[model samples]
Target: MTSPSQEEDDVEEWRVLYQETFGYRRPLFHPEHAVFQFQPDPKFPGHQRNNNRERREENDVDEEEDVEEWNPWKESYEQLSRGVHVMNSFEQFVGAADIQCFDHIDEALKFLDENPEGHHEKLIFLHEGTHNVNHTIRIASDVQIIGASSSEDIAASVILTGRHATILEIQEGARSPYLGWITVKYEVDTEHEAEMALIMEVDAPPPPEPNSSGAVADNDDDDDLEKVNEIESDQTTNCAMVVTGRGVEPIIESCHFQSGNADHHTVVVKDHAAPKIKNSKFIGGSGGGIIITHQAAGYYDTCEFAQNLRSGIRVQFQANPYFYKCAVHHQGEVGVFILDDGLGHFQNCDIFSNAKFGVELTSPNANPTITECEIHHGELGGICVHEEATGQFLKNRVHNNAFLAVWICGGANPILRQNEIFDGKHGGILVHRYGKGLIEDNEIYGNVLAGIFVETGAQPWIRNNHIHSGKQAGVYFYDNGSGILEGNEINGNTLTGVQIRTGANPRILKNRIWNNDNGVLIHEGGQGCLEENTVFDNTTTNVFIQTEATPTVRKNKIFGSRETGILITDGGKGTIEDNEIFDNGQAGVMILSEATPIIQLNRVHGNRSAGIEVSSKGECVVRENRVFRNRFGGIMIASGSNVADSSLNQVYDNLDRVSKAIDRGHCLFSVSGKEFYPMHNFYRCITCNSSDRNGICQSCIKVCHKGHTVMFLRCDRFYCDCGADHLERSCCLRQS
Candidate 1:
């Protein structure tokens, strides 16, 4: 038995011997573990090494302790078992189609123009493997340049980092001052070659020396300003005029773009050109990451933009970029920035920790559709829909933002609906003055401030939402916004569940507001309608009319509140009627200020406080009610509220008019009352009555405190079965 390493050495010798029989250009030549493509050898004398025919019954002998390492008997068995196929390196790899490699970037760019391989099918690689770019390369129509990977597996082997622009902005300017002062030619005249003269008359111009002021004195101050204005002509312009302009379409995909690491941009398209990009990752340099100008619709999808000094993607001069499914993070200043009426539609992108907003579509008509994206844990809001820009946001989950979920200052109509927003310090949606927008059906919960914050003068129609568990009310209407608030279930919030303040006459109707501190609180001169709502079980008052707002509170089931059911504090008034207010801990109605209320026809009962309590000195009428069975008096007129000899207020308690016996236990009752509205006045009859506990038929007299009584046929008190009673005429009763 020989060693395994020695056995491998024998195999390499046999492979080298067989490769000399065939002629082939080699690839990855190593003696021991060489590719069989280069070393196509099979015929060897050591291939016929026969196996050992020793005695069976475990006849094995090895004096060496490391038997696994010293034995080489099984080595040749593997080579004989699995035959190897020699790969032809020429046929294995084609001559690298779709890539025009050049020794220099200039040569590669020369090929980009003369080269016919554009968007149809072609890719370029700047394979100079050096960090030098004295001449820039302008990307022509529909051409892509991708860098080469070092290894086949692409682990880590690109040592050469060429500092060059993957796509450079070909700047073109006016030839002379006459072109700037043109009164006739409006559009860029690219056809007629105007022989425009050079304005600069520089003869043997000196090299522009830096660190010694700019072509003049060091702060000549007023003189420098005059000199700057003198050279402000087209002579100092650095632009090549478009001799024959072409509508450019190019995509700089999967290339390492470097620009001196200064505050410069990577891909600069200053002209009116739109580039479509996909599946590209960019490691940016000092310049702006991507700059679009004029009317360029730069469409980018599934791109990763990271580690840039300036904005991730910037658009200016009415040029915007449409982005979809792009990851933009770890940028220097702002991410996905658009200024000066530039617009873009951003969809399904992860934008977090950006210094500014995720996507900024500023100015007017710069609207965008931002939908179906999870924008969470961002430094600012998930999206800032402001600056006269409108947006349509749907099905987005914006959570854990430092600011509001969405900041909307839309000057026009913006629609933001069906978004679940939470975990922010501010409101979920903030609408400011020039903001006209529709907020509907957004699950805004567990935030610090109001859910939908609309300021004064914003009449946005808010409808159909589930807002719960916010720090303030669900929808805070302020700043004179008279929107319609309907069909919203606002529950379990801390403050007024839905506050319509700031003189906003919001139609607060058909909203199920419950379990908050106060169900619906209105203040500061908003005269609106609050009708057809089941406002119930709030901790504080159901509806608080504060600060001169007189909302019409009618046909609302205001019940089970801890404080007054309808607390009309301050100076607010409404016609209160037909509300089934029952079983609350406080009064069914509380009227404060100088509020003269037409209180009529409300079923106010079983409240601990008075049914209709007045707290102000005013002329009011409380008329016509079966208001009874309250813990305190039915109607309490407080100290400062009762007018001078109030005659219009009617109160009723235990009225008898030939009525039948009361259902509970009243002993004596008249049965011949035809026109009766529950004409029986019922009581327990404790002193002269007796009946079974939990029995359906209540006694017609007052029951005793611990014992009942018996009223006989002649008004005598017999000892009833349940208690002890007195004797008036002739009947007997027992105490039981």
Candidate 2:
């Protein structure tokens, strides 16, 4: 509302204040500090009048200046300049000076070249704007480069693009090139098909040259010039970040790396470089998230690696990487792949939902330790250790995998202890192809296959585990596999608790096996010892030995089986001794189909059928067994079978003491060493001292011995007085 002349005078006063306070040749304004006011100077009245006339004449040249508004509150020039100076001082102290701000990538390259020796305390700050670095910018030793606040801010402020070229290179002899608070993204439509955004090359310092006196000359002037030229020539590769160095320990913190190329990794640590990365994220790369190779080692803390085309982390060639509390998921291949002697240690990490195995290790000596981690929802197994890889898998929860929770093959020996491996489509742990290790103190259940499966000479020490509720056997050993299963609780399985077949020889000891279809099955030439095990409450035979399997089952308490306690059939031969076999629906020991089992010193009682039944050409030596309280006879030898020696067995309290089949149709009686055709055969009573000599025939045995209970004997010599007097005398009363 002021007059035109007064308004012109007020604008002139502000212009003089700004020029005197800032001492700038050109006018400058900041949008953020627009509310700050200016005061006119008092000492330069004639000079300010001359400047007012010059500014009024220049305002006519720019029409936009006429519509510009000024601040309402008036601040003195001293106050305004002091606030700006304080802020600028702090910014400059933190390495945010005007010389550090570079609008073009060439300016940054020139600055790096000028500071060849590298100021240790200096930090290069890329200004808040897009910077298309057409070539690589090599950083010197002990130099630090810090970008804007965050990855998103850097993305909006600095956009780096290169065509088949690396964006930044931390050159050789550069020590501790620390990169923080930045985002390095690779962008190229089609012309710039580069695969890298930054590369750190670490090389050893040049050796001193020999002078004419055969002594070492410390001449490094030409070497420095040659190194600069070599760095300038190495700007034409393709990667997101490549660390190629020997004995280099790079520190990267709070950085984000993403790539659009399908064959580019977000970060690659190669050639013995050991990098420590903290609180970083690698996302949306088509090649892989992070790769460590050529004996490189990496330590990552609280990082996230996701949405990669290949494995989230791929390590090979003796590279060792340690991941702490990181998340690796949604990968195209396995979450972490370690091969060719690569070693990895993953602790307290969440690895899930990958296309392949959660962690796959292969090749010789590729050892990795996965402890206290949750690995689940993998397309393949949770962890696949194959091809001579050995490590420790301790305290991990491996579940909900499509295949086995842990698949071991090709002689890989890994110690799996105190792990909860359950709810998988296949077995909980599978060992094949000569794989051997110690599986101890694990809870393995709810798997589609057996809880632990060992095949093809895989000899693992499976002990102290609780394996139950599996769709198949709790522990399955087949294909010539030999192992020791001790102190395990195997129960509630749909099939046999422990099955050994196909020539598997496993020493199963001290395991509580119950509530399964068959407690333990040794079949198909499987030979082992089932000792000190408590096997009970099975649906079928507690211990089934068949198909030429010779398992020495001793000192086992086997009871509560729906069928026979021990069924040895199909030429299976072993020693069954010192076992308590009772409370079965059928016989305690049933040997059929030519099976030859030596049964000794076993308490065989409380069964529905005979305590020991040998039939169908089965030959067994039943000796020193206490056979009693059975519904059928104590020992029943069927028609075609024979017990070679059934001695010292206390057979009592059964329906009959001992029942044996006798072919009476071929009986020929001989009297006084003369063979004669007799009408029938008579038998003697051993227990009763019978005065009545009632001779009994095979057909009418009950009528012949009305009040005398007798045992019909198959005597090939005589048809004499068969009474209690002659029972203890001889086999035949023949007067020769």
User: All candidates' TM-scores?
Assistant: 0.61, 0.68
Model 1 residue runs over 4 Å out of place are 1-101, 109-123, 141-144, 151-248, 256-264, 269-272, 282-288, 307-310, 315-321, 410-412, 502-504, 524-528, 572-583, 593-609, 616-635, 643-736
Query: Worst 10-residue stretch by lDDT in candidate 1?
Result: 176-185
Cα deviation of 475, candidate 2, in Å: 1.2
Instruction: Please estimate how well model 1 matches the true structure, expressed as its whole-model Cα lDDT.
Output: 0.54
RMSD of each: 16.6, 16.9
Q: What's each prediction's clash count?
A: 37, 8
Q: lDDT of each model, Cα atoms only?
A: 0.54, 0.71
Q: Encode model 2's per-residue lDDT on 274-323: one tens digit a residue.
A: 77788788877867888888788878999999998988998888888899
